[model samples]
Target: MTHGRSSNILFIMCDQLRHDYLGCYGHPALKTPHIDSLAERGMRFDRAYVQSPVCGPSRMSTYTGRYPRSHGTTWNSFPLRVGEMGMGDHLRPLGVRTALCGKTHMVADRKGMERLGIAPSSPEGRLMAECGFELWDRLDGLHQRASGKQPTHYQARMQARGYRTDNPWEDYANAPLGDHGEALSPWHLSQAHRPARAAERDTETAYSTDRAIEFMEDAGDRPWCLHLSYIKPHWPYVAPAPYHRMYGARDVIPVVRSDMELRDPHPILREFHRNRVSQVFSRPEVRDRVIPVYMGLIKQIDDNIGRLLDYLRKSGQAQRTMIVFTSDHGDYLGDHWLGEKDMFHDCAVRVPLIVMDPSPAADATRGTVSDALVECIDLLPTFIEYYGGTVPTQIIEGKSLIGLLHRSRAKLREVAISEYDYSVRKARVGLEMPVADCRMQMVFDGRFKLVNVVGFRPMLFDLAEDPDELRDLGADPACREVIVRLTRALLDWALRHHCRVTVSDADLQDAIGGEARAGIYLGCWDQGDIDQIIRSGDSGY
Candidate 1:
C-alpha cells in the first residue's frame, strides 16, 4: 500500500476500561454512542488482549511493541529501559511525527537517560518523548503525586481556573460532598456516588480531549500519530455533573461471579479476594455505589470521544485519519471477587479494540467485527504498516492488523498471551513468597484460557462452557488433557519469545558466512595467510 494522508493515526487509549463496557460491545445499559460510532465505522476486535493486565507494562507494550519481559518494564512505576525503542523511534525516520497529549504512566529510565546525558528538559528526556513521542501536553493525570513535590499540570490548571483548595484536584475533582458540604474523599466507597465538585470543562478527561484537539489543529502537513491517552474511568471513581447523574446502581451490569470461584480458590486468587480493595468491591453495596460512577466516567469518555470525532470531521481530517480506540488494560470492578486490575481474568486482560482506517481500501471491512486474536503491541506495527514503514520484526513482537483491516486475512494468531508480575505487592498482601514466585502468565485461545502461576497450581477455564470463568478445571483429573495442551502451548510461546534482546537465532544462522564471519582466521585462507601466521607466531616466540 502507498503512503498518503490517510496514514495519520489518532491512537485513543483509556485507562482501566473493560472491553464489555461499551455499547458496541453489547453493554445492556450504558450508551457509548461515540465509541460505538467508531466501532461502526471501523473494525471491532472482540478478542483483543493486552500484553500485560496492568497499566505501565501494558502501555509500555503498546508504545514499544514488545512484551513486558522483552521491554523490562514489568509493572507500574517500573521504568522502560533506556535502549528500548518506542513507536516514535520507528516512525520518525519515516516522517511520521508521534505526539502525546495525556497520561502515559511512563516511568522514565533516569539512569539510562543520565548515562546517555539526555536531560529531562530535552525532547528525548521528556516522559512522552522517552516513549518516542513529542509532547504536546504531558499530563500523567494523578495530581496527588506528581513526581515527589511537584503538583500535576491538571491540578495547576484547575487552580488557575479558580477552583482553589488545599488540594483542588482531590477536594474538587475526586472528592464528593459530605452532608455538611465538606469534601468527602474517594477513599470512602460512599464517595463513589458523589459527583465531582470540579466543573465539566475542568475535569482531567476534558483537559486531555481539549489538548488533543489542539495538537491535531497544530499538526502541519506532516503525517502525525497523536496518542490521545485519557486518565479517566480509572480511579477516584467520580464524574462531573450530568455524567455523574447519568447512571445509578440500576445501570450497572450484574457482576459476573459465583460463590464457587471462592471455594478453595487458587492461592493468588484467595489473597486477591482478601485484599482490602478486593474486599471492598466484594460487597454488593460497594459494587452498587462504585460501578455507577465508573460507568459515569465511561460516559464522559464517550462524550469526549464524540467531541474529538466531530472536530476531526469538521476539520476534514476524518477522511484521512486512522482512529484507534483501546484501553491500556481492563478494570475488574468486583468481577471474580476482585477490584482494580492485576489478574488474568478476561475482565482485567481483555480490552476494547476498535480501529477505523480511513483509507478507501478499508471500506470493505468497515463495521466488521473480528474475533481474531489481537494484542495491544500490534498497534505499533499497524501504524508502521499504515504509514508505509517497515515493521521491525526483530524488535516488535506483534503482528500488524493491516491484513485484517483490509480483509486480506481472516486471523492473525492462534492464541493471545497476557502476563502480570505482582511481586511488588507481595509484601503488602502479606504473601511471604519470593518475588520470582509472585507472577502469573495467561494464554487464551478462542475457546480456552489457561493461567500459569509460578509456585502455584495452574488454572484452566473453558470459555465456551464457562464464559464467566466460575469453574476451575485445573485440578480436575478429567481436564488433564486440556491442561497439558495449554501448558505445552504456553511453553512454546515462552521459548519463542525468550532471550530476544540480542541477535535472533534466525539472524545468527543467516550470518553463518556473512559479515559475522568476516575477519575470521580459518585453518588456512591461503598459502600466504598461513605463511604470515607462521611468521607472526615465530616472531612472538
Candidate 2:
C-alpha cells in the first residue's frame, strides 16, 4: 500500500460480471457503492480487456501474463499446460505467499505432471496442479445437477445447516421455494426471479468473502497475495432473501440490441445465435426476469465487498495492500444476439478495472479515469513492479501500469488484443470448421474493431459510428482499407507475442558479443584481428 518491499495484493475477480453493470461504469440504477468507492479512490480504466472471453482461458492469461495461445488453455475445463509460470510461480520465491479463496477455473495438467514424475502429493506438484496457488479454500461452484458426483463442501455446509437435499447446491443455494413447498430450479426464467431457499449469509458470495477474511486473519503479518474470487452473478442467477427482489423489470436499462443484427450475420455469429443460451436470452420475456436476479447477485457481492473493505481498514491491512478489483470477462447476456462470452464484443471482453494504490506517488492520479487500451496481462507486471522487481519482458507480454498509476506520462497503445479458440465449442460443428481452424482473434483500436476467424470472412465494425456495434463493415467494399489496416495491426501483435519464455533479455544481450569471448572469431584472418576485435567495446560479439 505504501512503499513497502513486500506488499500484499488483494486481487478480487468476479465471474460473468459485465463492465457496464457497475455504478462506477455508469449503470444508472445498480448502486454498487462498494466497487464504486474503489474507483473514487483509485484509477479506473475505461478500456481494459481480457485475452479470452471464457473463464479458464481468460483467467489463465490473467495469471500468467501471456496470451491464451501461449498458455494453451483456450476453453473451460482445459488444463493450463504444466510449466507455464503463474502468479504464484513468479511471486512465491520473492517472499510473497500466494493463495486462492475461490474459483480460478484452472483445470490441472495432471498428466503433464505425471509424465515429469512430479508426485501429486508433493508441495511443488500441488502448486503446479492448481495453477500455482496454495488453496486457502477453493470452490469452482459450477456444479451441474446431473453430474452424479459427490456433493461439494458447500453442499456439506448446507447439510450442516439443516438444508439437506439430493443436490443442496441446486436445491437450496440456487433454487427458490414455490408456494407448494417445492424447490424450483433457477434455470426456469420465471422461477429465477424468486429468492433462493438459502439464507443470505449462506450464499456463495458471502461464503467466499467469509473464507477470504479467514485467510487474511491466518496470513498474519507476512507479505501475501490473496486471489479472492467469487462465483455468483453467473448462470444459476439466483440471490438469497431480500437481494433477489432488489430491482424489478422497471429498473432494468433498455437492451442494447435490434432486429437488424440477426440479418445476414457472420457464419460464426449465426451459430452463436443458435445456442440455447443465446436464444433464451434473446427473448424479452426471459430478460425481464433473469436480468433483475443477476443485478441482485451483483448487489450482494458489493455488500460483501463492503464487509471486506471495512475489515481491511479495521485490521490495518488496508494501507499496506494493493487492492485490485476486476472480472475475468464480461457476460454477453444476449447482447449482439449472442450469449456465453466467446465473442469479441465489448460486452464480452471489456471489463471494469480499478486499482487502489496506497502509495503517496499514486496520490496525484487518485480517482482519475484512464482511456488507455489495456489487457488483463498488465496486472502481473504491475504487481511485480510494486514488489520491487524488474519485469521480465521476454515472457511477460504486458507493460506495467505503475507509471500511469503514479501519474507519469502515459504511453498510449494503438490496439488491445483478445484471442479465443472455439474448437472445443459445440458451434464448431454448426460452422463446420476444422479443429485447427476454429481460432478467433479480435483487434480493437478503441474505435475500429476487427474480428478474424481462421476459415471465414473477417467481421469488422466502426464503433465510432455505431457504438452499440450494430453495423458490420467487414463485407463493405468501401471499408476494405480499414479492414486491411486492422488486419496488419493484428499481424504486428501476433509477431510480438513471446514464446521463448525460458530465454531472457539479458541472455540475448550476452549472446551478442560472445563470439570474441569464446575465441571463435568470425571473418578473422589472424589472432591479431581477433585481438583487436575483442579489444573494442563495439566488437561484433
- Using all chains and alpha carbons, the TM-scores for the candidates as numbered come to 0.92, 0.95
Model 2 C-alpha lDDT per residue in residues 287-345, reported as the tens digit of each score: 88888888999999999999999999999889888899999998877788777787888
Q: Please state the error at residue 70 of candidate 2 in Å.
A: 1.0
How much lDDT does candidate 2 score?
0.86
Best prediction by TM-score: 2
Q: Candidate 1: TM-score? A: 0.92
- Summing lDDT over every window of 10 consecutive residues in candidate 2, give the lowest-scoring window: 142-151
lDDT, each prediction: 0.84, 0.86
TM-score attained by model 2:
0.95
lDDT of 1 by residue, 86-130 (tens): 888888888888888888888788887888888978866774345
